[model samples]
Target: MRIGKQNQAFTAIATSDSETITVRGLDLCDDLIGKINFTDYFWLLVLGDKPTEAQRDMMDACLVAIAEHGLVPSVQAARMTLAAGPDAWQGAMSAGLLGMGSVVAGSSEAAGRYLAEVIAKAEADGTDIETAAIASLQDHKINKRKVAGLGHPQHSGGDPRADRLLAIADELGVSGRYIETLRILGKHAPGIIERPLPINVSGAIPACILDAGWPLEAIKAVPLLARAAGLSAHLFEEAQRSIGFIMSHKADEAIAYDGKTSSRNTKAAE
Candidate 1:
């Protein structure tokens, strides 16, 4: 069953012969192994070109900012998966990564798209970015849609990680329209939405990296990659100290069953 267009025939990422491997036109062992750092290499691999210093720094900062939030749901899932199958780290990692969705580590893409929408609206309507942001947010509120990358549950006042990333982007001189749009949205979001919607790390990440030349389509990859590091740590600790069952036990104790009792059980008791 063919789903979509399949015209392209070859992968541009990498290829190898028996004796040598090539990545984006560079020799893997001789040209890239020791000389290029992982951050630069990541940019090269994704964009097919090396990042400038500011881009590299911004990317590195974002990766560090999101890497390990303390035992988020994805981490818990990974830990539990490892506890269930002690030998399958890959399974545990997949379980963790698969848990990332609109609510969690995957929200960066939503935020990026939101920023782009605001920018597009401004350009299309011949208005300022701030005006465009306000209108976009108002549309979201009217539609009862979430404004992603704003209002973290724990960071009502502000997300410290977000603040730090924005500051770093400014320092690196990568604060462009996307970052400006993010700040404008943050400033006016509360007034428009009738509640505080402080910018979060997810918001900050897309703004900084997009300003630094990351494609919006690849925004989710940043958090996914960062959380992979975090998940690996949790899985390792689960293997060592084993808290997966403890979390499961705690959850069981916490949630009360509210379902109807079986009539068969009542008859048996009677």
Candidate 2:
């Protein structure tokens, strides 16, 4: 569908002959063997436009942030679906994508509401910011009790992506109010917040997106943006693995009427 014309030639030549230049074998028509980079070729094949240097850098940053996660819910689902059959890679990858649709995995936009709620509470109370922050932390720990963004099963201490993202944000001249809030809390309310746990990547990603002027609702789209790449690789792996051919569920277990058997186990299994 009229993709692009950059390092490409218009071929009206007949394909019935052995001299045809199919999309699969178009190395470099003239001397055709300079080892053109796959990254450049991939960008050319898709998008229909060459990305600017800055665009490439940002895209590289985001892609590098989540290239491969081991046995995450999505990856687990993908592998499970893949391990059953040879040609089920697409099914397995689709299964993985389904598991990733959430605010917690969706990143900053979905998190904006929670951040705004906490910040608004501080602003509305008009009390000392440090005091209000401490109170909010306590209240959240008790009442609302909801947290979104930044999951690190492998790296328990923190997310490695956060530092690189923050550095890029600084270079992009993005004002990070979300990150600023953490700094404020760490400096002033260390007794309650920072001492217990540190600020995470999701917290700063919100600031970076906010600096980009995107709406808070945009968080949900990130899974589609991010996991899609992972899904592509996973589907390919599943296709190669000869697993995940069919989908089936095991039979349900017996349920005890009273306390004879551990019904709690049944419920937990569910």
Q: Write the per-residue lDDT of candidate 1 for residues 1-270, one digit (tens) a residue.
A: 877998888899999999999999999999999999999999999999999999999999999998898877888889989999999999999999999998888889999998999999999999999989988889989999888779988889999999999999999999999999999999998999999799999899999999999998888889998998889888888889999999999989999998987999779999
lDDT of 1 at 156: 96
Candidate 2 lDDT tens digits, 41-105:
44333433444544345445544565555546677677667776546666776778777754435
Q: Mind sharing the TM-score for model 2?
A: 0.58
Name the runs in model 2 displaced over 4 angstroms. 1-60, 85-90, 101-104, 107-110, 123-132, 144-156, 185-190, 193-196, 242-270
Q: Pick the candidate with the highest lDDT.
A: 1
**Model 1 C-alpha lDDT versus the unseen true structure:** 0.93
